[model samples]
Structures are given as C-alpha cells and as structure tokens.
Target: MKKILLAVAALALTAGMGMAETVRIGTEGAYPPYNFVNDKGQLDGFEIELGNELCKRAALECTWVKNDWDSIIPNLVSSNYDAIMAGMNISDERKKAIAFSEEYTPPPLSAYAALTPDADIKGAVAAQTSTIQAGYVAETGASLVEFPTGEETIAAVRNGEAEAVFADRDFLAPYVQESNGQLVWVKGQEKVVVGEGIAIGLRKSDTELKAKFDKAIESMKADGSLNKLITKWYGPEALVF
Candidate 1:
C-alpha cells in the first residue's frame, strides 16, 4: 500500500509539471522592424524573433498576443497579457505603470520627416498617441497632432495636415527612402533623444518572469548574439547594446 501511494504521488507531480502555464506576450503588430503582421497575416519582426529567442533561452512556454499600441501597457496591467515586447522605450513615466527588464536595444534617435526639407516642424508636428515623441511635441508647444498609429502620423504629413511627423529614426528611414523625394528630413532639425533604450515591460508583480527575461537578455548580450540580431533587423548602421 505504501509503494502504491508513492507511485500515485510521483504521477501527480509529473502531471503538474506538464501543465505549466503559457506566458502570453503582447505587442502592437503595426510597427515595422519591431513588431508587425507580415504578408502571411502572422506576427513577424525584430521583437517577435527576439521575444521567441528569449523564451526559448528561459525555457518559458510563450505565445504572442496582438494589442493596440495605445492600450498596450494598460492591458498588461489589467492581466490581459503576461508581458510586452513591443518596441517600448524605458522612461520614468512608464516605469510608474510597469516594471522593465534591462534594455535590449540602445536609445534610438527620434527625427522629423516632412514633405519638404524646410518643413516647419515647430508649427505642427504629428506623433503616435501616448508615445514619447508626442509628449515631446506637446512640451515644445508645437501643434501636437496625435494619431493612433505610426502610419497615420506620416499620412498627416503627406496630406498637409501636419507640418512634420516625429518618430523613431529607424521607423522613418524606410518611408523616407521609399518616398522618392516626396518626403525628407526637416532641415536644421537635429534628431531628438527621447527615453532610455527599449526593453520588455511586465507587471510590477511579475518579478519571477522579469528575472527570467533579464537573465536571458544578459546572456544574449554577453555572447554578442543580441547585437547580431539588432543588426539583422535594423541594418549594420543600427545602434546596438
């Protein structure tokens, strides 16, 4: 009877281990080179790839959840998801809402792009709602037009609704290059430095999950795999850890 009881206990422990919960990572599937829906209608991009790698290294069973950029943090706090791997910058204001893992990418340059080189960025600037760039525009007393997505901000500039659109330089580079002179960087306007480097966001209470990711990130950085992935997505000129 004693031997049978021990066998039952061992089977219960094995079943419990097999039932480990899946960690759901939330992201905005609109931002390119960071997180985006590809032609196959599946999530693909730098963050998607990196997030998967991090999960693999940490031995976490993870899944991706598409969430709008504006409510990404709020949803995370509401327990809609386990973490956020959307290219979110680390800032004090955001830290008040959620904790961040160590930075995975360096602080990126923010710039203004408009139809003309001399566009008056100081007059009317469009930015994605709830982003650091929008906050900067508001503080600078510019006519800060907010959009729900990065694509809309550029559309505002193209349609003369805004004098310029401010966003991450990497996100803007492809548009400027493909515009065929239709869009250009605002002349005499230096790229702005906003927020700290990009990092994964988690609920303040998810210390164990945060620690797992932090360790994985540190491992990638130590072995230089992190830099290689950054270059693969952002190009050789892209900033690294």
Candidate 2:
C-alpha cells in the first residue's frame, strides 16, 4: 500500500465535526503491541497508549471504541466513532472514503511466515481480511485464505490450514522468535517489501480533527517520543521518521 493524502472536503458528512472536546478513538482490539484487549477486558496496546497521549497533548476529551477490523472503516463512515487509531495504513483506496493524519509510524515490510523455512507457499497463503497483505496474496499464485483477525491468520499456518501467513513483519516477528525452530519467515517467496506508513484515519471532512492529530504527531516526533515508542513496541530495528 502506497501513501496518499486525503481530501477532507469530499467527506463533509462523515465527521462528528461540532464536538471539539470529545472524540472517540476506534481500533481493532485484536492486534497486539499495536492494540489488543487485556485479560482485564480493557483495551490496551501501543496504539491505545499513543492515542491517549495524543489526546492528552491536544487537550481533548477522548474515549476508546473497539470494532472488528473488516468493518472498521465503514463503521467510522457511519459515525460509529470520531476517528480511527487502528494500525491502519494510509492508502489511496482508503483515502477515498476517509482522511488521515500525517503518519505517526513509518511503513514497514509485511512478511510471510510458515512452519519451516522452505515451506512451499505456492498455493496456500493466509492473511487477515481486508489487509494489503491479503491483496498481495490474492495476486500471487497462492490460494488466499482469509481470517477476520491477525491471530487467526497466523494460527492457520500453525494448524496446517494454510502453508504460510502474511502479515506485518513486526507483528509476526515475536511469533517466529518464540517458535524455536518450528516456524520461520518464508524464504524465496517472490515477495516485495510492500506497505505505507500507518496513521490515524479520520473522516474526510474532519479537518479540525486532522489538524489536531497532525500537530500532536509532529510534537511527538520532534520530542523523540515517536521513535521511543516504536523501539519499545517493535524493537530497535523498527523504522523511525
């Protein structure tokens, strides 16, 4: 997915524009490090923490909303929440339906994982629904199996339901490292380093909200908190700036 700027004027009716004080941050509570629900049944993750910090820096009253990743954007268009803080990439196609704040996290590669290093991923690949990695798998010779959550995609490979799992490298890194020699990043898969920066998705009409978040992101970058959080969650080698 390549990054593209959004046109807020085209989405005038999509934002909860009048409420300058309260903004509901939407996220998929299934992706860890980026976002997830803790054992306490409360939303917690890097995105949640960063979102709260942004709200705090912007002096805005904010609340969190959990939504399924597949329908996250549609629900946002329906006013389910004020903005989306999910680890969503800012793409040209998505920008048609919503706007985005300047990217807070730089785009990192999406990689493939399998039980063995040389697994034949020719016709069996798994990816989360509606993700760029899913689209990539679909275009490959692989038979694309879809799942609603990131967890399920990885599980598919483990259970022999799919030959390989495609997802963000950072998200899949821990799984590979924890698997001992059981799992590894797929080698010679004819892959391309595909992805764009991750940013907060907003209604195309929410210029005020977009401006607020952009300023917050810029502030965090300037103060080095953005890089700090990246390293904290995705490790030292993760992309910064």
Candidate 3:
C-alpha cells in the first residue's frame, strides 16, 4: 500500500510539471485603469490582475510584457507573445488581423466634449462617429487633430488644442474627472453614437489559446470574481455587459 501511494504521488508530480506551460501576455502599459505602468515602473491595473488570475486558473506559467498599443497585434502575429490582455476593443477592423476571446469588459465607446462653461458642443458631435477627431471636426468646425492614443487625446482637450475626445467610456472617466470635469459626455448620444463593449485581442492563428482564454473568462464571469475586480476599480455601472 505504501509503494502504491508513492507511485501515485510521483505520477501526479510528473503530470503537474508537464502541464506547466508558459504563456506570454502582451499589453499596452500606457492605457490606465486597464493596464499601465506605475510610478515605480512596474506594470499594474485591472487587466494586469485579471490576466494573472486567468493564468492561475488555467494553470499556466505567465509573463506579462508591455508593448505599444499600435504594435501589439503585430507583435502577437510575429510570435512575440502568446496573448494580448490590453483593453482592446473587438472591432471588425481588428478581427481581420487577430481573434478575440469572449469579451472581458463591456464598456461603451463614447464621446466626450470639452466644456467651456458656456459653449454649445452638441451640434458639433451629432454628426460624426464616436471618435474624438470626428467629434472635434463636427462640433468645432476645425480640422481634426490626430492623437496616437487615448491619453494624448485627453491631453489635447486639456491643452485646448481639441475641444473634446472619444474613447471607451470607462477609460475616459477617471481622466475627465481628474481634469476637473472640464470634460463631459454628450448626453442623448449614447444610443446614437456608441455601440457595445470591449474584448481581449489574440493572434489570428491561436485558436487553442483563444479557446482557453474564452473558458477562463467565462469562469471569471461565472464565479463573480470579475465583478469584484471591476467594482474595485470602476464601480458597478462600468460593467455594461
């Protein structure tokens, strides 16, 4: 009986070791509240913790690596990473290049207008899509200024270079508040402008990894673990889906 028990333990240990697979996760450390670098130069945020949790649940060794948002998909396609955990939206454009797991966050893509206390910014945003440039051009009748990322778009509004910007509502909320409410959403524009939520980006060919991530995300959602994490950083309303 003792020999049989020892043999079972050794087999279990070997199986566990064989199951250990390192998964390299790529994220844009620039997007705050989702994934970003702290003052201490360490990566931190909602997505970072979520990724680690998924890794744990999936029983995979994990390494989180930061990549520029624009290059994230390319890096994944180039085999630089096994997955992407950045707050990337699941859009038709992106889907052509990469696959997405079940959506993790369902935050809306919405428009934000710069408030001058007295200026009417509505008519400006009523025409364009939920994009800062489109809104800026429509409302201010000025040429749209291109910004590389969400942070830069907010900065443009703060600098008065642009009257407003557009981004995922959750991503823009904290910044708008921190900017002293200089930014406000264009009311009644919700049903008209923005669509649904965001999803995780994955390499196009990584079907197996995609399946594992989808299962992991479903598990997170089912266990109420995702709710706790969102509530910690974004509050209840942020989980639209």
Candidate 4:
C-alpha cells in the first residue's frame, strides 16, 4: 500500500508541475492604446487585455513584465521573459534578433506630427530608437533624432528639439487631438506604410510557445473578437485581421 501510494503521489506532482508552467510576457508599459501604465498604476492597454485572453485560450500560465522599449528584446533573448507583446512591428531587421508570432495588426500608417502644419519634416524628424520609424527616417536623408521612448519623440517636437515626430498614426493621433491645435500633422507629407504588422516576439527556440499564440490569434480572428478588441482600443477606423 505504501509503495502504491508513493507512485500515485509522484504522478500527481508531475501533473501539477506540467500545469503550473508560467510564461512571462514582457512589454513596454509606455505606449498608450497599445500598452501603458494606466491611472491605477497597473499595466493596462489593448495588449494587456489581448495577451491575458490569449494566455487563457492557450491554457498557459502567464504573467506580465515591464521593460524599456530599447532593452525589451535583449531581455527576452537573455531569458528575462518568455515573450514580447509590446507594439512591436514585424520587420526583417528585427526578425534577425527574435522570432515573431502571426501579426495581430495590419501594417499601420506612419505619419509626422509637428507644432506647425507647415513644419518641414525633411529638416529633422524624431523617432523612438530601435523602431522601424527611426530606420525609415534615417533612409529619408532627414536628420534623425532618436529617443528611447515614444513620449520623448513627441516632446522633441514640442520642445523644438526636432522639426517633427514621426511615428504610428494611431499613437500620434491622440496627442495631436489633445494638443488643442498646438501640434498638427505636417502638411504635404504622405503617410508611409511601415512594417508587416504588430506581433508577439519570442525566442527562435521557443517554437512551441509561438505556435500556441499563433493558434490563439487565429481563433480570435475567426471569431471576430480580435477585430472588436482592435476597434475598441484603436477606434473604429483601426485595421482588423
């Protein structure tokens, strides 16, 4: 009886261990609408909600970790977290560093915002470092001023550090509206398409984890819940899968 009881307890312990595996999700809690530290001082945003739902669907125990945008990838690669759900766009340059799950968002419009409508975007443009927008600005021959955060990039324009700030139109739209005419889109500048889309970042070796999220995302797309969440956070005009 003692031997049989011991074997049964071992089996139960093994099963519990399997069920308790936790996946750590890393994000930059600074990008609003996408992810942000809300008024409650807790991580809250579109990604926060979507990520939690994805974990539930995948049946994976998950937790959130906040990291700076520039270091988010490095930390993930170093095993500080299991995945990245920050508003990171899927790009070839980034793929060299980490693998990505299926895109959750379509290629978003990139635009320039400046204090004046006539501001010359070609003169100087600010973009967050390590972002595709920064790379775009660099290729355009405009002086590229890189900041570590999206907020600083916008502040660069407000404080005259740069002629304009180039970033995702969705991220910039709220600021422009709240600026009360102090900031406006640079006229005559066409919005450019950037990246493939936003997706979860994972280490290449974590194919199993990536597959789980991809499956969850596909289900959301099929059921239209993903579109509802996108529209809820990004507004009705947001692109949906």
Candidate 5:
C-alpha cells in the first residue's frame, strides 16, 4: 500500500508541474520602441510592458527569452519558447507556421529618408534593392540598400551608407525624434503598406491559451487599459483598434 501511494504521489507531482501556468516568451531585443535592450542590457519597451500586463490579467507567470528575429518563430515551434511577443506583425506566411493571438497592437509601415547633407535614398529603396525587385523595375530602375536588421538599416541611413529605410512607423517615429528631424517619414498611403498588427505567437495546438489571451485583450480594450498604454507610449494619435 505504501509503495502504491508513493507512486500515486509522484504522478500527481508530475501532473502539477505540467499544469503550471508559466509562459516563456520569445522576443528580439533589437526592435526599438517595441522590444529593445536598454543601456543596462535589460529588456524594456512597449511590447515588454504590454506582455507583462497581458500575463498579469491572465494569471500567468512569464519568462522572457531573447533570440534573433530570424529564429523567433522557429524557436517557438521547437518548444524553446511558449509564445512570441516581439512586435511581430501577423502575416499569412507566418500563420502557416504557427497560431497567433488576437492582435494586441497595431502600427503602420513607414518610409524614412536621411536628412544629412547630400544623403539620398532614391537609389537605395528602389525596386532593384528590394527582394521583390520588380515594383519599380521599369519606372525608377533604382536599387535598395538592404541591411541585416532594422537597427543596421537605420544606422546605414544615419551614416550615409543608405539614403532611407521602410520600417514600422512605431520605430520610425522615435528615430525621427532622436535624429532631431534628420530622418523624414513618407506617410503611408491607406491600403498600400504592408500588413500591420502586433500579436503573440503561439504553438498551433495551443488553442486554449490563445482563447485566454484573446479574452484578456478584449477585457483590456473594453476597460480602456489598452488605450491608456497607447497614450503612454505614442500619445493620443496612436489609438489603434
């Protein structure tokens, strides 16, 4: 009887461990104003703050794990992380690999041109420089100067290696402010920019968790918590749905 009881206790312990509500979050600490590592090497940004709030509402403990942008999704699939909150846009291609929670944030795609004397991106952001390389092939015949990361792209524009970059408006706004208007934004025309909306990436099978997150997001939205965070981050004009 003693041995059987011990065995039962062990099984219960294992089940409890498996049921713990600990969520591991994956993020690229390189995307500024969204997710970035500070001067002290600590992760702090809009996404980070939002993640903490969502987890709180859902009664889940979160552990942040940093990885490269390229590996963020793959790592989530391999179970290296439970969710991704790296300011990722919900795209059809990514949806094929994993499931996404309802969009918690929305930002626009914007273009940035350098302000340094003699700096020009007319050649860099053209079709020839883009991966598609077909949009402006006949009209402009320009080439884009591609960088490995958003930071690098911005740096290139700042250092005169490139003339401009097209990136998330959230990140671009801060850059313009930091550069003291050295970088200019070409406002995106409605319905023409790439997709926009920030969501949490989860495993394809985690429907339960997704539902929970969606509920929390909806509750936050109804309570105006989400708007409050938006106001805190980008002020009144950024009240996204």
Candidate 6:
C-alpha cells in the first residue's frame, strides 16, 4: 500500500502537480444514491457527498470522475483515477486486482423485481455486467442477461427483453415504488447476499490513500455519521454495522 501511494505521488510530481494533495475519486454516476448526475448537471449521490466529507476530514483535495461500471476498476488500475468510491462490493475475486478500504456500509441486499409478481424469473433475468447479481443468476442456471447499467437492467424488464431485473434492493426500491402496479418484487422471494460489503477501491500499492479513507470511515462510524448517512439514503430499514 505504501508503495502504491509513492507511485501515485511520483506520478503527481511528474505531471507537474508537484506537492499537490489532490486525489481523483472515481464513481459510476449511473447508480442512484451511491452516485448519479443530478438535474443541475452536477455529480450528486450519497457516495459523492460522503466522499467529499471524507476528503475534508482527511485534508485531501478531491475531484470526481465518472466511469462506466464495467470498466471502473480497469480505469483505476490504469490511473485514470486514483480511487473508486462507487458502490463496489469487497470480494476475494476483486481483491486479487485491487485493495479495499474497510467497508463503509454493511453488506447490501440484492433482489429481483418483475413487471408482474408471478413473472417467471427462470427465463431471462437482467443484471449489470460484472456484478455479483449477474453471477448469482448464472450460477442458478437462469438465463442471465447483462446490461451496462442498472437502469438498463430495469429497462430490459419493461421492454420484454427480460422477465425480471436483479439489483440492489435500495436501487430497485424507488423504481418499484414509483411504478405502481407495473413492477413489483417477486412474491415470497428472498434477497440474495451478493458480497461482504461496500468499500472504496484503490490500487494494491496505494496504501496511504487507502489508509486515509479508512481512517475517515472509522471516524464517521465512531461519530454515528455513517449510520445517519445510511438511513438517510437507504431508509430506516437499511442495515448498519
């Protein structure tokens, strides 16, 4: 981790930003609550605000970069950005490629929603590419159709491209609630445990950057701001730990 921080620091010096403490934070702006582009054409979401607060607490100047979900990690490794604050789950598979800060939220729930309560999910289910939800459907022997974004997954359901959509419960909840009878969670369906928890993604060598964010997260957790943020964005039913 220390080596990674030095690598980035060296890069910063070479780029003529010598001694600058700026960090570029990457996120998939398509994911709501975690991140999204607001109507004012500005980046806005729980993670965006949270990341800003973390940078403030850590005394690091930060900027936001929007990346596609499927390639978010690759971009990070390529130095397109320094860290990923997207709603990314911490998993052994990903850990091989990058290191993670301690989780900021408890594990998130993934669920299925269909146009009708009885829609046959065994047929075609939509999930974002490279997501655990997609892996779950494929492993269960269901037809797993991948989309690049959560909105596309839901669109696949409404357009008959898929029988159902699988995604984070918090992400799909608003769509289901606003769709009236047009969409509903499968009756009696159990939420799937997609991964361990959501955390910031950093290069394996960026130990200092990771430590900075980890310390900020710990402070937030200790002061109750982390739980407050979770409840504010994910509702009272949101999990905390």
Candidate 1: segments with Cα more than 4 A from true spot: 15-21
Q: Per-residue lDDT tens digits of candidate 5, residues 107-190?
A: 444444455434444566522122112232223444656554677777776676655565666666777777776776643321
Clashing pairs in 6: 1-207, 4-205
Q: Quote each prediction's TM-score.
A: 0.96, 0.88, 0.79, 0.95, 0.79, 0.90
Q: Which candidate is the best by TM-score?
A: 1
lDDT of 6 at 181: 80
Least accurate stretch of 10 residues (summed lDDT) in model 1? 186-195
Please list the residue runs of candidate 5 whose C-alpha ends up more than 4 Å from where it truly belongs after superposition.
1-20, 107-109, 116-122, 126-142, 187-192
What is the C-alpha lDDT profile of model 6 across 162-208, one tens digit per residue? 99998888899899999978989987653767899999999999999
Model 2 clash pairs are 8-204
Q: What is the lDDT for 175 in model 4? A: 96
Using TM-score as the yardstick, the better of models 3 and 6 is 6
For model 6, what is the error of residue 13's alpha carbon versus the real structure, in angstroms, after optimal superposition? 16
Candidate 3 or 2, higher lDDT: 2
Q: Count the backbone clashes (under 3 Å) in each candidate.
A: 0, 1, 1, 0, 2, 2
Give the C-alpha lDDT of model 4: 0.93
lDDT by residue (tens digit), candidate 1, 92-191: 9999999999999999889999988888878999999999889989999899999999999999999989999999988998999999999999886647
- Compute the lDDT of residue 3 as modeled in candidate 5: 100
- Predicted structure 1: clash tally: 0
lDDT of 3 at 63: 96
lDDT of 3 by residue, 116-228 (tens): 53334432222223233344345556455665567777677667766555566667678667766666665643322343356677777778877888899889899888878
Candidate 5 lDDT trough over 10 residues, lowest sum: 127-136
> Comparing candidate 1 with candidate 5, which one achieves the higher lDDT?
1
